[model samples]
Target: MKVQRHKCMNERCSYDQQERIPFATGSCSYTHRLARYVIDLLKAMGLKDVSGLMDVSWDTIKDIHVRYLERHYSPPSLEGVDCIGIDEFAVKKGHVYKTIVVDLRTGRILYVGNGKGADSLDGFWKMVRKKGVKIKYVATGCMERTGCK
Candidate 1:
C-alpha cells in the first residue's frame, strides 16, 4: 500500500512531496509543518498511541502545533466598532477564568482577555479605541465582588 502525504498548512500555500526538502535554515518544507499540527492535535486529544493512530512522532506534533499557534493566534488589531458586551466565564475545571467581549450590534465576540476585572475590561476598551471603534454603551453583568462597575 502507498502512503499519502498532506500539503502545507501555511494558509493557501500548497506544496506536497513524497520526499522531504531542506530549506536554507535546515527545515523541512511547509507541508511537514501542517502534518505536525494534525499530529499534535491528535496527541493532545489522547490519540498518541500511534499504532491505530498512524505512527506519528510526538516531537513532530508539538513543533507543528507551536508553529501553527504562533502564526494564527498572534492577536490582530481591532478597529471600527460600536456597542460592546462584556461577559466572563470559568473556562477550565479548577481556577482558570476568561472574559469575552462582543459587539452587541453585530453579535461577534471581538476579543477575549485575561482575568475578570476592570483592568481586563479596560484592556478591551483600549483595543477598541486603538481600532477607532466608538464606545456608546457597555452591556455588562454585575460586578458583585471586586466592586467593578
Candidate 2:
C-alpha cells in the first residue's frame, strides 16, 4: 500500500505529512485483515509455524498475539468474590513456577504471579485488601507450606 506524501511548497514553512492507510493502524505494516487472519491461524498453530506461514518474524507474530490478548482480555474484576482457590504450578521442568488465583464461584482467574509460596501472593493480597474483598473460604495446593488459610 502506497501512501501519498504531502509537502508544503512554501519556502518559509516547509511541512510534510503522509496519508494514513485506512486498513492499517498507525505505522504498522500489516493490515487489520492480515492481523485478524494471523490471530485466527495462531489459534490452531504455534508462533513459529504462524510466523513462517505468514512470512513474518516470530517476534511480530508474538507481538500481534500479545496485543490481541491485551485488547480482548483485560483482567477480571475481584468484586463480590468470597471463595478463592490458589495454586502454584511448574511452567518448565519444575524450575519456573507460576501462581494463579481464581474465583471459586465464577471460575475466573483473578491474578497470576511469578514464583511460588507466600511471596508470590503478596501483590494479590494487597489487591484484595485494597478492593475490600471479604474472602471467606480459601483452597490452596499447599496450605501448611504456604501458610494460607
TM-score of each: 0.49, 0.58
Residues 1-149, model 2: lDDT tens digits: 56899899998877987788888877776889989999999999999999998789998888889989998998778888999998989988999999889999999999998898888888999998889989899998778655586
lDDT of 1 by residue, 1-149 (tens): 24357779788887875533542123443365456547565655743553245565666555556666787677654555657677888867738778887877777777887877766566766766567776777777846522345
RMSD of each: 9.6, 4.7
Specify the highest-lDDT model's number. 2
Q: Which runs of model 2 end up more than 4 angstroms from their true locations?
A: 2-22, 87-100, 112-117, 129-149
TM-score of candidate 2 relative to the true fold: 0.58
Model 2 vs truth, CA RMSD: 4.7
After superposition of all CA atoms, the RMSD between model 1 and the true structure is 9.6
For model 1, the superposed segments whose C-alpha errors exceed 4 Å read 1-60, 70-77, 90-97, 143-149
Residue-pair clash count for candidate 1? 1
Query: Highest TM-score among the candidates is held by which one?
Result: 2
> Residue 57 of candidate 2: its Cα lDDT?
93
